[model samples]
Target: MCNIVGIYHTLPCCSSLTVSLRCSLLLSLLKVANYSSLDACLNLRWPSAESEILPRHVPKGYFVMQVLRRCPSNTSPLTLQHLKSVWKDVAGDLNVDESLLTDEDFLCCCGSSSPSVNAILGGVVSQEIVRAITGKGAPHGNWYYFNGLQCTTTVEWLPNSAISS
Candidate 1:
């Protein structure tokens, strides 16, 4: 549960260095975990609800876009192999560990529903993105647990009605 936020004091600006720095920082944070523990590997963070001056003007009504992928947990091994193969074929590189699919960390969430590992991971990444884009909050990632049997959703943070305000 790592929450990270980057703040830009200045306004109306864009720089490759800034983007690169943010990406690198986030990646480093993610890479620190073992990725093996179902509890340890998951990250759940969100942006601040408070308003802050933007480094650059985001066009009015620019809604945040989210991309979601629902991957079957059982096919992770096959998926990893395919991704590695595709990378090798396209880039003529073979740096990825095809066996990682069998790693304990990688296979931690093979069978589960409600608050599935996939959802946890996705939520973590999404929260980080939100924190990076909106510079507010205590930098503590939030968590949610859902029960498939009970069909209940529990949220760590209250939903914000004025996210952009």
Candidate 2:
């Protein structure tokens, strides 16, 4: 919300600015960045009045944060390592490596005999790209899945990593 931010910055004491004004300002900022609407960004809800402002505090070395901090950089080796860790968590320790895997690699454990898996996976990836570029819906950061049985598709998000040269 650039307009809101601008308005806030210019007129910090304007008490009459409504939520709609804030939203409008935010939308303007997104527009300048080539985004169309608020839905293009992740939806985050504010805490309700009844909710505690400070919940149970984390003691700094939380496991989730540790994993996040170790997220692979953009280098192929680092990406592969990240994928290995993800696969270990999801598929339980498959012997995956960087060998032929690119950052864009899409692997399906479905048997080689099943060409359907390839088609489905490709379609799912394409759909995700379309959604991301068109800003039609949420951005699919990295992973995607297609279930031929259910004819359903899902997208997964991955944290951004800083690759050292």
Which candidate number has the best lDDT? Answer: 2
lDDT of 2 by residue, 8-52 (tens): 244233344665675666556442222223332122112323222
Predictions in order: lDDT: 0.34, 0.38
User: Candidate 1 — worst ten consecutive residues by lDDT sum?
Assistant: 59-68
Off by over 4 Å in 1: 1-92, 95-115, 136-165
lDDT of 1 by residue, 61-109 (tens): 1111010022333655434344434433322221222332222322223
lDDT accuracy of residue 131 in candidate 2: 72
Question: Highest TM-score among the candidates is held by which one?
Answer: 2
Ten-residue segment with the worst summed lDDT in candidate 2?
52-61
Query: Clashing pairs in model 2?
Result: 1-25, 1-26, 2-25, 4-25
Q: For model 2, what is the C-alpha lDDT against the true structure?
A: 0.38
